[model samples]
Target: MSYALTLEEMTPALRVLRLIAAECAHLPAPFVHLTPIEPERLELSLHDVDLTGDTFNVFELWREALGIDPDQVTFRVQGNGRTRVLRATGPYGGADVTLTAYADAPAAVTTTTGGAA
Candidate 1:
C-alpha cells in the first residue's frame, strides 16, 4: 500500500507561531482570526479576550516571546463599546506581525480591495 506524504519546511516565524499556539492551551479562544497583509505581513485578531487584566495578557506575553520591545508596541483602541484593541506589531523572524486581543467581537481591519470593512 502506498501512503501519501506531504511536507514543507517551517519558517522561523511559523515555528514561533506554533510555539505560541501551544502555550495558549490555557486561553479562551483558539485560532480566532488570521489575515495575510499582502507581500509579507500577518494580522492575528482575537476577540473576547482579557484586554485589561494582567492575569492573562496573551498579547504582551507574545510580544515578550517574539522579542518585541514594549515601547515599540502601538496601543490602539478603536470602535465603540466593543473596542478594537491592537497593540502588538513588530518584526518577528520572517513576518511583520500584529497579534491583538479584543475584549469583545472584532471586525477585520481591511478587505481584499482594501476598505469595505
Candidate 2:
C-alpha cells in the first residue's frame, strides 16, 4: 500500500496498536477511539481506555497493519443492550477489517479521511 511512513516507521507503531488490542481483547468493547491530540498525534482509547499522552497518527498505523491501499478507515461506536464500544476498520489486502459489536462480531475500527500521507 502507498504510505507516507515507511514500513520501518510504521511497524513499531502498528505493533503498539496491536499490543493495545491484545490487552483489550477481553473487553467486550470492539473499538478504539482515535482522538487527535496535536498536529499529527492521536490517542487511541478503548471503551475504558484511559486517555494517555502517548499518541500516533491513525492512518499511518492502519496502512502498515493492513498492508493495502485503503479507500478509507471508518471509526464508529455501536451500542446494544449494556454494551458500547469504539472501533476501527479498513480494507486490507483483499479483505476488510470489520469491527462491529453484535451477536456476531468482527475484528476491529477508527476514522481518517485523506489519501496516504
Candidate 3:
C-alpha cells in the first residue's frame, strides 16, 4: 500500500504539518487534526503535550530542524500547556489527516523543506 499523496505533491507547509504530527505521535495524546483556517492558513491540533517534559515545544525544534520561517506560521497551545495546535499560512493547502490512520499508514514524503525539489 502507498499514500494517496506523495512528497513531490505536498507543499512546504503541508509537509511541516505532517512532520510535526508524526513527531508528536509518541506523546500520551497525539495530533489529530490538520485544518485550514483560511485561504492560506492551516492549523494542527494535538490531543496532549508533556508540560514538564523537555519536549513541550515541538515547534521551535521542528521549525528549526525543518527551516520554516516564523512569519509563515504561528501556534496556539492550550489545555494548561498540555495541548498544542500549530497554525501555518502560506503553502499548506487542504492537508487534513487522522492521527491514528496516518500513524498506521503514513505517507512516504521526504523531510526536505523549502523551495521546489
Candidate 4:
C-alpha cells in the first residue's frame, strides 16, 4: 500500500514517524511507512521502539516534534493490536498517523479535525 503525503503538508506525527524511522535505520526493510488515508490521517509502523532514555510519551514527543499543541492531536490504539492511530488537526491542516507492525497490512486511516466549515 502507499500513502499520499506531501512534504509541505507533513504533520508532527509524520515528522515523528520519520524521526523514529531514521533513528532505527539499522533495521530491515519495511521497518517504517507513512501513508495518508484521507486528508486527516497517516499510517506508520516499526518492528520495535526502544523506549530507553525517553522521558516523554508518544503524544508528547509527537507534539514537540510537530511544534503543535497537544490538544491538536489525539492518539488511539486499535483493539489489542500494535497499531496506533493519531488524529491531528490545526488551523492550517489535519491528518491521521497510524503506526503498526510490518506483518499487518496498512488500513484506511482517516480523520477530521475542527468544526465543520
Clashing pairs in 4: 40-95, 40-96, 41-96, 42-96, 42-97, 42-98, 44-98, 44-99
Off by over 4 Å in 1: 1-39, 50-56, 104-117
lDDT of each: 0.55, 0.38, 0.42, 0.45
Q: What shift in Å separates residue 101 of candidate 2 from its native position after superposition?
A: 18
RMSD of 3: 18.6
Mark the regions of model 2 whose C-alpha exceeds 4 Å error after superposition: 1-3, 30-42, 46-117
Off by over 4 Å in 3: 1-30, 34-43, 51-56, 75-86, 90-117
Best by lDDT: 1
In candidate 3, where is summed lDDT lowest over 10 consecutive residues? 97-106
Tens-digit per-residue lDDT, 37-110, candidate 3: 32123344332244544333544443444345667565455555544455443332244332210111223465
Would you estimate the TM-scores of all the predictions?
0.50, 0.26, 0.30, 0.30
Clashes of each: 0, 10, 0, 8
Model 4 lDDT per residue over 72-93, tens place: 6555666566455554443212
Best by TM-score: 1
Candidate 2, residues 2-50, lDDT tens digits: the string is 3455544544445545664665444333354322222122234333222
Q: Clashing residue pairs in candidate 3, if any?
A: none
Which sequence of candidate numbers ranks them by lDDT, best first?
1, 4, 3, 2
- TM-score of candidate 4 relative to the true fold: 0.30
Q: How accurate is candidate 2 locally (lDDT)?
A: 0.38
